[model samples]
Target: MTVKRHDGRKADEIRPMTAKVGVVPNADGSAMFSFGKTVAIAAVYGPRHLHPQFMQNPSTGILRVNYDLLSFSVAERKKPGPSRRSKEISKVTEWALAPAVNLEEFPNTVVDVEIYILQADASTRVAGINAAAMALAHAGIPMKTLVSAVAAGKLDKELIVDVDKEEEDFREGEGATDFPAAKLSGRDEFSLLQLDGKIQPELVPKALEMISSACEKVYEVQKKALKDFIENPEGGNGK
Candidate 1:
């Protein structure tokens, strides 16, 4: 039998999400976001001096974002050292957030964004991106647009959005033949593919459609949260 999500959410439904800004006292700006069971915290530091001097771009400030996955958050015990997975995630987070930030305004300076995964149900990368974006805004960093991220996957022969661990397991077996197992294979369509299974090339359009819609819904939550923080700066609690 196929495992269903708790809310009976459709395949395209993104988990309920909330964003709060300025959660840290020491960082210049910070934000925390919860998407279903996955939680991520991001802190923005910088425009600070660079080391060795040579690393500085000279024309524009650098945007550095660190993403850490806490061992306690996941079910399995994780090794302390950084993983190739984390490195890949860090690169993607930086790319997704850099375009939104106006680095040119602070030439020779650097803005560092840190993302910590407090909980990992699923979709941690998307959560990290959301948290980082909120933290940057709370820090008063100028941005062109708010970046959004989400994952789409195939399950039980159907394409789904925001697949949790339970749903994922349903499709992982030799008996799992009926589902859309081969609808889309390569993940080139998505900015980041978190799914372990494959789908066919023809189904790429459908997957993009699902992911985009989910992102817009999430984007609203982020905008509202940042707006609330702006109206009540003290409420932000970011030092």
Candidate 2:
């Protein structure tokens, strides 16, 4: 018998999603994305000068991402300032997004992406990546394509897409398998793939297959947000 999701969604179904662009006026570009209760906002500041000349890469502009989960985002307040996990996820976000951005044109410069979670249920990093990708495009940064990301894995014996905090805390035998991934739009290639927990080796392909479809859904929302913002720079609401 197949197991049922706690939220009554089909194993392959994701929660309600929202996307918006041009939310921060002072920023060169900014956007927000949410997967159910997890909301992430991203601001892009530059393809500007890189200070400390020695650190500049003369051949390519670097992508720097800072991901912060606000102290108030969760029920238990986190300490103010960057934690070890936040720092790690920042790098992960950069790598997940670098493939789609064309940075070589702005050599010796840096594009800084700041992502903050206004609320956290789970899969916050994936939400951040979705927002950051739109923010970069909103900033007028050149790009090969936008990126879309999602978390897919198994809750106990059932395969699922877009795991929530409840699924993340599942502690049955073999527990939860959390797989977060990002992909360039319209491509089968994955730019980011991170795994937590366990899954059968044979099931890897199935999970990837599931994630690809999920990313497509994400890409559509991102494209719409960008298009709406362009048509009306009045700042579109999350759709």
Candidate 3:
């Protein structure tokens, strides 16, 4: 059976996307990223000194992340403060991005990444991580490579890449799976792997391959966005 996405995207196609850097003038580095209806803005601040209490290692810089969903971002207004879900996402985002950064470059300082979701359809975490990675590059933080992410899911017995909100809802039903993964660009190492639903063991390999290909595409966009920003600091559309 052929499954048609509501947005008209093919099973293997990602949503229409765009990424822009230097969106927040006050931040050391900032980026606005969008994937279809989901939009995430990220700001990076500091390679500055971390307070003694927050400093965990004396020889390496700390990578701190705060992921927030604005109250008006969803269909129903969300609460103002950080929820348990947001906190967990923040921690995972930090961990996912740390592997791509050279934390030792800043010694005892901290690089803080803050992501705000202005809108959401699905795959908000992936979008947020992408924005954060770009923001880090925009801020001139030393990094091994940009980190890119994508979510692949099983819907109607067919595997799909970059699932939107409607497909995500479908995955919540029986026998469906929503797998979100992230990896550093040009490397086989995975930085994040999360499975939201059950999947046949045999399907894992196929799903990983699908998401990895999607992440590579996203990485290309991220690189272009950062390059445009660097070349045209005054104004660049990030085409």
Q: TM-scores of the models, in the given order?
A: 0.86, 0.96, 0.94
What's the CA error at residue 79 for candidate 1, in Å? 2.3
Which regions of candidate 1 are displaced past 4 Å? 1-7, 172-195
Identify the leading candidate in terms of TM-score: 2
Tell me, by lDDT, which candidate is best.
Answer: 2
Tens-place lDDT digits, model 2, residues 1-239: 56688888887788999999988878989999999999999999999999878879989999999999999999899898999999999998999999999989999999999999999999999999999999999999999999999999787777899999999999998899999999998987798899999899899899999999999999999999899888887656422
After TM-score superposition, what is the CA distance of residue 57 in candidate 2 from its true location, in Å? 1.3
What's the distance in Å from true for residue 159, model 3? 0.9
Please write out the lDDT profile of model 1 over residues 1-239, one tens digit for every residue.
Answer: 44355569876787888889879978888989987899999999887887658889889999987887998988997776679988878887787777677888788888988999998987788788888888888788887677777766676467777756566566444212112111111222233444455667687677777777777777788888888887887876746
In candidate 2 the C-alpha lDDT for residue 113 amounts to 98
Task: State the lDDT of candidate 3 residue by residue for 94-179, as single tens digits.
Answer: 98999999978678888999999999998899999999999999898999999999988888578889978888887434645678
Q: Whole-model lDDT, candidate 1?
A: 0.74
lDDT (CA) per prediction: 0.74, 0.92, 0.88
User: Candidate 1 at residue 164, lDDT?
Assistant: 62
Q: Considering lDDT, which of the candidate structures 1 and 2 is the better prediction for this target? A: 2
Give the lDDT ranking, best first: 2, 3, 1
